[model samples]
Target: MFLISMIIWATALLGAVMTVWALTWAIKRGEFRNLRKGASSIFDAGEPIGRQTDFFPPVRKGVR
Candidate 1:
């Protein structure tokens, strides 16, 4: 149905517009201005980025 397709397209376009609008609003409101600080705030230097146990591959029970 052409009418259904048009509605779907319009809704998708509207969603995209809203997403861009919200992102712009956040940037204008200074939500993402401190990119460097935000990255550092997430982790401490003394902690490992990942677990040490992940260094080795798991053994397969029955490989062909």
Candidate 2:
């Protein structure tokens, strides 16, 4: 029982840390800026792919 609790706590902590890291990573990578502009650009199909908002998270270790 102790082992199981430790495993669960460790997993939860790892998940929380990874989540914050990813959010900051995205912001630093300019993924959240100009979100409205990026969405608007989608409708303008004729235009080339310009600045876009990345809503998806990065596939990192133990990120499910």
Candidate 3:
């Protein structure tokens, strides 16, 4: 029982440390500098904003 408890505590501590380290690294790397650009990074000229690129099956003509 004691061994299991110690392992659990150690794992929790490690997870907490990793989370803090990742957050600090991101802040130092300026990952949160660009808000809008990052949000639209996946979009390109072929698929601009406010444009529906995907269409479901059974698409009828002259039906938007």
TM per model?
Answer: 0.50, 0.57, 0.75
Q: Give the candidates in order of lDDT, highest first.
A: 3, 2, 1
Report lDDT (CA) for all predictions.
Answer: 0.81, 0.86, 0.93
lDDT of 3 at 28: 94
- Estimate, for each residue in 19-60, the C-alpha lDDT of model 2 and write its tens digit: 999999999999889898877765556555674656688799
| Top candidate by TM-score | 3
Q: Per-residue lDDT tens digits of candidate 1, residues 1-64? A: 9999999999999999999999999999988988887776755666645534335666788953
List the RMSD of every prediction in angstroms: 5.0, 15.9, 4.0
Q: Which 10-residue window of candidate 1 scores lowest in summed lDDT?
A: 47-56
Worst 10 residues of 2 by lDDT: 44-53
Each candidate structure's count of clashing pairs: 0, 0, 0
Clash pairs, model 1 backbone: none
Candidate 3 lDDT, 1-64, residue by residue in tens:
9999999999999999999999999999988999788899888999988899887777689876
